[model samples]
Target: MNTFQLSCFLAVAEYLNFAQAAKQLHVTHPAVSQQIQSLEKELNVKLFQRTTRSVKLTDEGKVFLWDAKQIVAISDRAKKRFGGVAGGNIETLSIGCYNFPCMFLLADTLETLRTIRPELHPRLQEIPFQHIYRMLEEGDLDAVVGFKESANVKINALYKEVAKVPMVCICSGSHSLAGQKELRLCDIKEERFVLFVPPKGMLSIAQTQGQLMGERPPSEFYFCESAEAITVLVKAGYGISVLPDFLVPDTPLISRIPLKDVDQVSFGIYYKSLQGNPALKAFIQCAKENLTALDI
Candidate 1:
């Protein structure tokens, strides 16, 4: 009928003595007897055969004992599992990021969280740039890392700039510009270009580069959705593109030239302003610490 009644039934069944069961449960003998009677009444079955000399289980009591034990065990486990929520002992921090930052920053942040709050579970979800703000506001994500300026200031979230990732020019190994150590916008203005379109309303690497170049657009614009795709096109000698330094994979077939005039993209962490989750705070702290080491 209830955990307390079931517990009393189990104690009596285990010892087969009302006085001993009461002693084991730290309750009075009459209290134990009352609970057993209540349970029998609730189930409409007698659980024990009692005599002046001794107490013994009914045939029904033996079968019901197993179910009672199982119910008690399950109740105990449920309490242990959910009891920590009020105490801040159990937490799962869901972090969102675009592909490149997910690859570069998520690992170090997870390691730090493991060391500091081993009880906290951390999840990393690769999200498109446009959906990040919506996810954070909707309680789907606890925190996110991406281009700092890309996050909408209109959203109710806190933003902390963690790193500045410089944009670099990538060209095929065979391209003439590949020989250059550094380049400016003027040098690549005439070269066919691959442009990355930011998801949603966020600014892409190409758009940022164009802002730095003033009224000049690329000689030819080839649009792609992701950094990886742009890299593939660049490697095939289709066009040159600008990308964050960390997004450039280590490959000899592609050459990365530093851009002198373009400002570095600011990467930051964003979390819902009102949800002061401890795990999110720890993750933000860990991210700031690992930014320099991650070289972003």
Candidate 2:
């Protein structure tokens, strides 16, 4: 009912752990619990099902989560609007990216946007991939910048592609496949696979790797939450992974081989609409003009 209660609810919903949510909100665990309890009492509905080991959202909580995000975003925007008016008219936009690498792709675009709209402040947040689009739809994020397949377009969302980067096979420098100039599916089918955790609402990179592997799948599979973890595993010769070239860091310890059959991923900005937002409109244009020029 109140912004405070909604904040507590959302933090709890995101983390699914009261202690972790309290840590994130910089509040004590009991305080968060009290807020959730009060909100549930006021609504006459249980928002969460809590036990000793885990906390899961109730049916009502799942339904309210989207609305809560929108409510908080509107509240934040209103505060920022008035606060900006009192402090020299500074506008802020929350931009979300999946990971650090995806965020790095915005460097040139953000710089270019600064020149055109100096008063527009872009707040870049590296959000989890699964939550990024959900946050965008709930208005917590004004826009998102990341890679998507060329064919992946949503009816309600708009994507402005800046550039296309090919997927590559990532392996340890000392691996047998490292000496290959280019790799095909069969070339590495027998090797162990390290893949990203399955994401929601977008194309699954792991699933794509599975399709590429076809009938002859790798004997072992390892899943990781981040590209960094995947890289670490590959460096230790645990397994190889397929990722966008930019996500692979430049290091002699790892080798990246161009994928012969995979389609290039389009790197771009995904926004709901540019009809009313001047900052987002300017950012999309800047990204289109500048991101294409990046060496990556």
Q: How many residue pairs clash in each candidate at the backbone level?
A: 0, 0
**lDDT of all predictions, in order shown?**
0.79, 0.83
Task: Write one digit per residue (lDDT tens) for candidate 2, span 49-165.
Answer: 999999999999999999999999999998988876466777898999878887877787888888889888889998976577888888898888887633554424677878878
Which one wins on lDDT? 2
What residue runs in model 2 are displaced by over 4 Å at the alpha carbon?
1-87, 149-155, 200-204, 212-219
**Cα RMSD to native, each candidate?**
6.3, 16.3
lDDT of 1 by residue, 131-221 (tens): 7779989999888777665443476777887778887999999999989989888788777777765343245564765654456554466
Each prediction's TM-score versus the true structure? 0.66, 0.65
**lDDT at residue 3 of model 2 (Cα atoms):** 99
Work out candidate 2's RMSD over C-alphas.
16.3
